[model samples]
Target: MRILLAYDGSPAAETALGLAISRYGDDELVALYVAEVDPTTYDASAFGGGTDDVPDSDEAEAVLEEARERAVQEGYELETAVEQGSPSDVIAEYADEHGFDQIVMGTHGRQSISEVIVGSTAEQVVRNSPVPVLTVR
Candidate 1:
């Protein structure tokens, strides 16, 4: 089971990792950290953690390191990447490109008009993915 765990260092994403680990065991997991930086745009602010306190590159690196450590502690043979693009597109493309058996991700739990407008990483991935996607909230 080549499981791709979409990690953002968020609480919900952590839950997704936990679920994947518990369900599929550590040996099958791959940890993925996407920077989601809009490559065409020169502005870095449009992507990354979206916090002024942390620079985009540094923040993404930190999150990747944290996820790697955690996955290692669980005994998974983990792989990582920091990509620049739309989150949903990157995730789906990576899964397709690498031939992952399943994709695990977190949903932000936004509802109503806000969710409809802002959209969601989980939603798009589930919709556009060529493989199976497990959404955790």
Candidate 2:
């Protein structure tokens, strides 16, 4: 069984990783971290309107490294990647393209208004993914 684990270094995502390890220890585990690019973060810099520096890839790498270490501690070796895109789209597409048997992810558990406005990445992935998705809160 090939399992794709969506990790972002959040507490919830870590919990999801743990669940994946515990449930599918022998399966091939792929840890994926989507470094969502909010255009607002770079728009100003791109236009040279502000002095704020464009963020580096270091942060994304750090998140993946942490996920890798955690999986190692759980006795599961994982393949990892840091992708740039919307979280839900990247996760769902990657799972589908790679032919993963399942996808494990975490939800922020936001409430009504906030959830409606910002939307839930896990929920979107669950709805769009071609494979089964297991979401941990």
TM-score of each: 0.78, 0.80
Q: Which has the greatest lDDT?
A: 2
Positional deviation of residue 48's Cα in model 2 after best superposition, in angstroms: 20
List lDDT for all candidates, in order: 0.75, 0.79
lDDT by residue (1-137, candidate 2, tens digit) is 99999987888988888899899878899988776656655453464532223243577678778888877887889898776556788899999888899999888632345446867888888889999999898
Candidate 1 local lDDT, 60-92, one digit each (tens): 778878877876798765676676557788889
Ten-residue stretch with the least lDDT total in model 2: 47-56
List candidate 2 segments past 4 Å from native.
Answer: 38-56, 109-118
Clashing pairs in 1: none
For residue 47, what is the lDDT in candidate 2? 49
Look at candidate 2 and tell me the lDDT of residue 117.
84
Error of 2 at 11 (Å): 0.8
lDDT value, residue 135 of candidate 1: 92
